[model samples]
Target: MFNYAESIASRNTYMTSIRETMAEAQRSKPAVTISMDGDADGKSHRFYTNRDRLEGDVKIVAPADTRFDEIYITFEGTSRTWMERLGVSPAASGRTSVSQTFLRLVQPVNEASLPIPRVAIKGQEYTFPFTFVIPERLLPGACNHTIAVENQSVEEAHLHLPPSLGDHTISTFEDKDDLAPDMTRISYAIRVRVLRKKDTEDQPVVLADTARKIAVSPSIPDAPPIHIQDRSTEFVLRKEKDLRKGLLGKKIGRVCIFAEQPQPLRLAPNSSCPPSTRVPVSLTFVPANAETPPPELGNMTAKLRTSTFFSTQRTSYTPTVSRSTPDPFVGRYQESTLLSSRCVSNVSWEKQEPPLSSSSSSKPVYKAQIIVPIAEPKCKHLVPTFSTCFVTRSYTLELSLSIRTSKHSQPNLALKLPLQVSQPAKDSREHDSAPQDTSVEEFFVPRIISPSTLQQEVAVMAPPPPPPPPPFDRRQGQLPQSMLLHPPNEMPPPEYSVFRGTGGPPVRIPPPVGISPGCG
Candidate 1:
């Protein structure tokens, strides 16, 4: 008689025992730690793309008998963005996203095989060092891809493509952004993984894996010298009661504003300017009439402002109706102030009286020199200036001057100037000459290791060079000296063959026959 129930119970117990043993072994496995050289003592996760070389070490802590199938580290740059719809019904919702990848570098890590192959034992702790270079040109994202046509039509449809068709091509890196938290995001990260070989039918398993976020920003170049001058039209201090009446209000004197600098202002990419750079500016206020005195200049201020405009078109498909319809392209605009200069407390006025003999009159002139300082943004949501079918960012320099007219009322004058910010041109020498800052080192440090211990580990893990190849044997009948010294002859002309038919063997034709001397 066969007892099937008892047999099944015994088999179940055996399988459970096997699983327990495997789990226990995994728990006792050694830990893996990774760190980069030159990272800040407190912050060791961030890295940059402009770094020339990145060096790091991997440490494995395991029992004396523990073994590893493979050990290596990989460096990569990744960019991802997506959008989701909100609202009860799909018909009422809209979609928006940003795509850009200014920097991307991926280097395949070369693994160092164990001497015994698939067997590694560390009594205490073992470390392996690796180094790689950051490439000057990053891998182009699909977003930067363009199609060439002899002639292309300019139409709304042609300018905008649906996300489904353009998603793959939307590959470009831009400054990090957290705007539209529910709508879009851009980021970069470095990931490390370790694998362990398995003896069972199950595939090789990952023993340990970790990832860290990295910030990538365009480098700011030195600003160039710039000078600009403009004059305002005369207008009344108060608003007119009617368009037909021209003399309803008192007239305020016309004013001229002058600005000059020794160098052109350098704008950083994505409207994010560095806090260390400053723009030197000189302003002169001149009244329209030489007889009129210049208006008293009160508090004066300047600021850098950015405006972002975005547009998108959504299409809906109805299965029952067997038709597709698209909604009109909608646009949204938002403005922000990035940097502001300190207020100018006061301005000195210089008066020039008329000459004793001449009848010409002179007006008072107000002059002031102030340095405009740039500061970092208050939030992390700032993004570089960019323009695409769906999004565009623009910047401006705004200057406001307050005028003291009477004891009770003071009028304010405002001016807006368009500003352009960009990275250095590809051919510019500044890219190569830019000084490297140690604060943005491209290395990661494990949290568990101390500074002294890390230095010792790196020193011990340095690899030694292999021995030189054996010397060549001269007695083994080397090439003759005459042959080695002989000059090479001219190359022979290429031979030509003609095919008679498709998929047929080629037919060789001899050189055209020539008449003999006697026959000629």
Candidate 2:
């Protein structure tokens, strides 16, 4: 039989030995640590693109009697994406197609090395201070360049039918994030490595390496506001069986909708007043035709819809032809209704009679003011509206009106308007004209936490209850509490014969039909 337990135990022991040996070796290797200026506790690892320079120190600690051939530090910025087909498609035979691409935002490697050819050092620590300038034109975030696929054959193979059978494909720019759900990632880091000299080898070996993650954010300018206008004319037809009214002809009425804003609404990744921002809307209804009077208005609704789209170009490689051709950039757009609210459901309409005076020239007009509350950013992972090659985010607003009339029970009117949300500009006209102050002052302030305050807050949140009393014996009632709690121990029961039954002792069987005890 195979002993699985022994095998596992042996494997565990071997792994433990290997880990201990590796740890011991690592302890003797040279290590590197980074420290940045303006970071009091040496924990801030963020950098800005607008900044001119990044100053930091590289600390190196070597074991006793350590010799190194060279020591260097390198900085890099990388953006990578891996995408798979989301849904079922004819092109994806049994499995989904996946494509991976790596973009080097900062192509040229920036490295700094010690000038000394060979350095011999005792057990000591060394610090090397350095500074590097941030590139002004570095890409703000993870970005990709994608073009629409134009191959007819590839499109036909992927589609269920001919291109004419379905809606025409529209090209769009998509903006994605570092933590996008499409398994995309963008990262920036700094690495430090050391080369140590080894005995009996002409080439030096890599002793130790260390890397630290850094955050990079580039400033983007704000966009302009949007304006939209829509107009429609609803004609009132003559009633059936009214021959006299048909000869006179139908009456025409006009409905106009106009919307305008001075500035674009802004949505930031981490905004404090995300929900407070609102868009003001004005709704106007006019009864122009004299023959056809305005119907009774019932309810009105204003809905704001937000959508996020993820798109990418897939390149297919043919094994038989030993070549690869890019497929048409297929984009899957998804829309989500972020917010919907009824502006005015119960509308009261007042009938305005035409004036008898001949000089008066006016019609009945009804107006209402609506303020649509903008949807707040639900998840902290939400990115500002942006357009990129692979991903895009857009928003739309819809207004619906319900009309109730005697003849027609329910009549609905709808209008769709496009909206553009952007970030506030850093240098607007108002900011540029503001006065500046050149006063300079310095002061020291300290904050201290009191133990009692912490205790009070904890008590308010969850008060502690008194500990339960120790277990008690009811048989020893009225005894002293200490004696009852800690009673003296007693001896355990004595053991009995193993062969006897459990009823105090074995029953002596007298001779069951024959000699029993003696014969057994």
Candidate 1 local lDDT, 432-510, one digit each (tens) = 4557654555455336778998998987897867776565444444654432322223112233333323433334455
Specify the highest-TM-score model's number.
1
Candidate 1 ranges with C-alpha deviation above 4 Å: 1-30, 40-42, 45-49, 61-72, 84-88, 91-112, 115-126, 141-188, 196-205, 214-249, 258-291, 306-345, 349-395, 418-520
lDDT against true structure, model 1 = 0.45
lDDT tens readout by residue for model 2, 1-520? 5499989999999999999999888888776888767767655433233233456878887775566766666655443333455446757633232332222322122234343434536456777775655443434222222434345432322221100001111010012222233433344455677787778998878887876555544333454543222221211111111111122434334444444442344544323555335555555555544445554555656555555433344322111111143233433343444355563545544455556774356666555555556564343223334443333445556666655444434445665555555543333343225354424212334436499988877788996797866664647667543334333342122321223233233234345576555475
TM-score of each: 0.49, 0.48
At residue 7, candidate 1 shows an lDDT of: 90
RMSD, one per candidate, in order: 19.6, 32.4
Name the weakest run of 10 consecutive residues (lDDT summed) in model 2. 161-170
lDDT value for candidate 2?
0.46
